[model samples]
Target: MAEQNVPIQRMTIIRTLLLFLAWFNQFLSMNGYSPLPFSDQELEVGVSMLVTFVVSIWTWWKNNDITKKARSRTEYLKGKGIM
Candidate 1:
């Protein structure tokens, strides 16, 4: 059976928002303005933690999606006696 060429969506709005936040924080610090309550170092650490957490979650979600797709494909092949 021919494989179904479905494209998975890899881009997430949450990640983009996180990236924008980090960039905006840096931009604010560079302009000598502390828009947030935390110090620069503290903000960096906090943002770093957020990034790590988001990345972990995203990785798990993507892996889950891929696994589901693989299982579906496998079952399809088995149904067609192609496995």
Candidate 2:
């Protein structure tokens, strides 16, 4: 239970940070100072979509890292007959 909660707690912190970043990005876009500079397309669909895609990929990577770590620990303990 302790080990399980540990990863979950860390993941929660990271998720909150990502949510804050997403909201910050949205606020910038509404105010006309989005990260990607291009006065022509204020409603830059491609740029916004790109950021969203990147965030998705990042989240997927984080989840994968967590899974790999958990698996490695589990396997290590099992190999030593500690599990």
Candidate 3:
């Protein structure tokens, strides 16, 4: 299938911002600043689940692209502008 020219940098920035917000929220809670109504334990659990889910999905998506299309590690790195 032909891939769309998705902006990887834009996606990365957005994902980073989202993950930062999750961690920042947790940080605030840990320091006794509760932004949400949930208790600390509840908040911790919720954030843990959210971070795990996002990371899992991100890992799967990136790995799928690399494994399905890249001929080698070097090719994958080059494609990602990391080489």
lDDT of 1 by residue, 1-83 (tens): 99998765557767888899999989998999887888779989999999999999999876663676788987898999997
Q: Higher-lDDT candidate among 1 and 2?
A: 1
Query: Which candidate number would show the highest lDDT if scored against the true structure?
Result: 1
Cα displacement (angstroms), candidate 1, residue 6, comes to 24
Residue-level lDDT of model 3, residues 1-83, one tens digit each, is 99899766888999999999999999997997877888779989999999999999999877664564455776779989997
The pairs that clash in candidate 1 are none
Name model 3 segments beyond 4 Å from true.
1-33, 66-83
Listed in order, each prediction's TM-score against the native is: 0.46, 0.37, 0.42
Least lDDT summed over 10 consecutive residues: which range in candidate 1? Answer: 61-70
Q: What is candidate 2's lDDT per residue for 1-83, written digit by digit as tens?
A: 45554355788999999999999989988997756565646557777989999999999876663677788987898999998
Could you tell me which residue pairs clash in candidate 3?
A: none
Per TM-score, the best of the predicted structures is 1
Better of 1 and 2 by TM-score: 1
lDDT of each: 0.86, 0.81, 0.84
Worst 10 residues of 3 by lDDT: 62-71
| TM-score winner, 2 or 3 | 3
